[model samples]
Target chain A: MKKLDNTLIIGIGNNTRQDDGLGWCFLDALVKNGFNEEKLLYKYQLMVEDTDLIAKYKTVFFVDANKTALNEGFLIEKLTPSKKVSFSTHAVPPNQILNLCETIYHKKPTAYLIKIEGYEWDFKIELSKKASENLKNAIKAFIKEF
Target chain B: MNPRKIIIEPVTRVEGHGKVTIKLDENGKVSDAYLHIVEFRGFEKFIQGHPYWEAPVLVQRLCGICPVSHHLAAAKAIDQLVGIDPENLSPTATKLRRLLHYGQVFQSHALHFFYLASPDLLFGINAPAEKRNIVAVASENMELAKKGILMRKFGQEIIKALAGKKIHGILAVPGGVHKTFTKEERAYFLDGIKIPNIDTMIDWSKEIIDFMKNYHLENAQWIDNFAAYPSNHLSLVDKETGALELYNGRLRSVDFEGNELLNIEDIEYRYHFKEAVKPWSYLKFPYMTKYGSANGWNRVGPLARLNTCKYITTPLAEIERRIFKSTTQNKPNNMTMHTHWARLIEMLHCAELMKELLLDNELMATTDLVRKGTPRTKGIGIIEAPRGTLIHEYHTDDKGLITKCNLIVSTTHNNEAMNRGVRVVANEILSEKPEITEPMLNQIEIAIRAYDPCLSCATHALGEMPLIVQLKDYQGNLIDEKIR
Candidate 1:
């Protein structure tokens, strides 16, 4: 398989939900902290399921807050698996999107899952302090990898 | 005799989700009528803590129908707060902005006039829901309906050329517009004009006036006693000449008799106007008083503007003033139906204004588009949106990050008026009938819809469940519960 060239940093969450916006928050911090806009590619909300957008990138970094069965402020790291997680309402899952890319373009991009632990997803304005702190830490870690 | 309950659910062919409910009392009297909004997108809350620069783009998303109006108002507000004289923008850029705005006003009004309200006026109220649409009207009056569509397309094209995107163009910024109109763009805009159609539209408007004169005479009676409130009318007046300004002007509020309320300098808005949240809806009602709930039925848009302006500037607008004046009863306030006439007059004004700006030689001068500034200050931007007065107030930190943002959209200003109008129509229709038919209720709904209330822009209440109205007799027995 041909290796991917560009890195896609996908931030996924409903912005209306306060702490659920951690993934976007971390991405925004990265953008603010002198991250080159050219190298960093693709930002999406809720789900990165746009077919056209998914097909172009070689590497996909899915950044989202994991609310179910995860420690608060913990990072869950994983590589793209053959079997994709099933979620209703999404156009296509992450693995399926990658597979489609490979089938069509004769190349598959490396994928990384960076899920931040979130405490509250209630309808509120301000972010929880713990989630906010975890977001800063996640950004720091992501930058180290860069 | 049992009075029938009529429910117009998910009022179609409009911008937002709203419903009209008419309730009949035991005496068969129309006890209550309501034009209620179901869904609420909290734009005010969403915009908080973002950059002040994103105000235009974010606020524009509030309504797909009137994105240009929101864009212009947001840009004007930021320009005021940044203390940049947007009048310094090349006249061509200013004209382009005006042209785009005119397009928004024309298309939006045309949508209301042709698609929404004209169905009831042209066809009887009892017409089938499926047939009561612009398509039905177009089938009978194809050329006339096509004219409106053509006019709307012209406006959209102008917006697309200037703003890059016709709907939510981010061209208007703090100092001035980002894009300039090339000679080719200007020629292309002028190329599509149907010159003969202008005469046709003028004739069609005259026919509309005649129709309203014959049939809507009683409709005009409801607003006969309407009194022009002497409160301040706020608008963006040109800073240089103090003439009626559209795009880049300082916020000025004048009374009905033409008295200045306040200059509303960028920093002084917090002192003049305060935003109050209502428990009934998510939309924040803005009041002129420094403290307390928003009181009194203050108005915005064309009616308030006409009352405030000393005289109409454009020739077509001046001619159209007769249509506004022709319907007046004892005083100026009686002709609420004149809002329709007033809207057309403004459309003419907007078009003429665009032409004037384009012809000016000074418009071609390109100086500074973006002023280099690092000063962070909280400021308010106010402009006369097409529907009414729109205010966008922002509190920003020293880094220009938005701490809090409040938008008093056009529909919010007309909320009280719309409710009052609904009540008046209900009272008039319900008093005479022992049994109300679905058609009668539809007429009442049409009366309220004539205002063209932007429910999306208005305050959002909790989601509307199926309305259940129960009527009880004096004996405490369950009389009836109408479920719709």
Candidate 2:
């Protein structure tokens, strides 16, 4: 068992929405692999108050289901603060959250966004076959690096 | 030449998907305008056949922003199905429910003001689209943004503590609540160790109201006149004292001149009100049947509540209410943008009410959490949600299954009012202008945002629904289009 101390991982998406549950599945894989449960946070979407949670940690990872095509099953890229104005509060993008964290609390944590390629997004709990494969690969990649 | 129509789809910064349609006659004069709610979730229709008790939990699928409101409203109705009236509920249960309701109101007001309305107030309507959002507000005024966030967080914490989660948590069950407030849970808000104390919430609430006052002073012309119109006002007031009451009270309505229109028992709303549907929107127009469709529509929410109430029960809020009333010379304030001002005053009121409940010792009572009475087949629950009066009615069968359900949410009550506002703003801003800029389109959104309508509770997929303004002629051909 490895201790990922001083780190926070947020899985953002709804489990009920088929492949959108990829983020939660990734975190679930980490838990099964003996990762600490306290370090992981689950959310349906990002909100303004999330800045407070991310500000306390030294490093943060945001796991979400991606709609766009990807070279690999998953990709992990560093996230920087973005000033992109969101039209609605329905979905606050990860970059804007980072920006809010820096602007509001003045704490800049090292952040990475792990976007898993999701093929299906309908009203079902189980992931699609391809999405499941991507989740597994994403979990393996996440574990290999961390 | 054919008449022209301009559409602004999915207006920004509000909760859900909505659009504004402004029609121009052949002469380029504004003929009509409407704020259409495009997203549809047949929640009331689908809620049928579930166990009557499940209404509270299932109805929470309404909106993430104000699920607690729906949860409680349904619970109040379910209590009737279980044969318990509101008065018969235990003191502890009533207190717990009131606290949760106040928390919902407080957080919702804070969110609306800070995230949605403040951008327009802070940067003015003429500011660039990018500069009129939460990120820009935070960048420019860090302290105000921080306070807004924390004030909202405090109310959410209260909801989380009582309901189990902030968004979809459940506290009330059939006759009463399932749990009581604990001393440990209470201290988290009172001790000022982990989060800002309730007193801090009170102070911040007052500060924001003051900020609104100053903003109003500086921008009185627009703040006072923009989309301003005379309309009826509706809310729930204390049955006995006629003071501002959110949790449980008589349904009160007043005309624009402060004349009492209707004050009825909450359960008798069906007799007085009717919902009329429009061809353009899924949202229904709710109005007093007596006043007919045209004039019966009453504006609900902070401004309406202030107008209909005799006074506020809380000391601090009563004082602020007096000042708010004085601005309009004790008349029903018809200034639409003053909704922000009224909403801030309500944030202060909710904070004060939460503090009063947090200190009361009865809140810790573990006994009498649930109550049961003579069972009934029909129940109606009405509460003043942060936005306005919310009604939930249920009809049950022998097996206690919901046979039918109807909801007249706050936003539905304000549908006609919002359409009127859009017409007002569009006529003023876009009637004769040859070129419509993004900021000009924003003025229409500014009017609708004042009501803070929760347009849809639909799914928020990982994409932005950009504001699309399309100019189309009477033949339905796109003449011009703009996107932001």
Q: What are the runs in model 2 whose C-alpha is more than 4 Å off?
A: A1-4, A69-72, A120-122, A128-133, B457-464
Chain B, candidate 1: TM-score: 0.81
Q: Report the number of backbone clashes for model 1.
A: 5
How does residue B265 of candidate 2 score in lDDT? Answer: 94
Return the TM-score for each candidate structure: 0.66, 0.96
lDDT of 2 by residue, B1-484 (tens): 5699999987887888888889998877889998878777788888899999999998987888989989999999999998999999999999999999999999999999998899999999999987888888899999999998899999999999999988899899999999898999999999999889999999998898889889888988989999999999999999999999998999999999999999999899999999888788888888899999988999999999999999998898899999999999999999999998999989999999999999999999988899999899999999999889999999999999889999989988999989999999999998878777899999999999999988764221122468898999998999988887
Residue pairs with colliding backbones in model 1 are: A13-A46, B77-B381, B91-B363, B92-B363, B301-B388
Candidate 1: which stretches are off by over 4 Å? A1-146, B1-8, B20-26, B30-33, B85-92, B124-128, B193-278, B290-295, B329-331, B361-367, B372-374, B459-484
- Candidate 1 lDDT over B1-484, as tens digits, reads 4444445565544456666655655566767666666677777787878888889888887775677888887776676557654455445556656767766776676656655666666676678654565555655665545555455555556677778855667778776777666766665654444232333334444454455445456554433433222343455555554555555555565544455665555335567666655454444556667324434335566666665454566676766565565554212332345555566666666666656654554444565545534344755666666777667777788777787877777777665555556667677776657555556556555655655667676653223323244444434455555553
For candidate 2, the per-residue lDDT at B174 reads 90
When candidate 1 is compared with the true two-chain complex, its DockQ is: 0.02
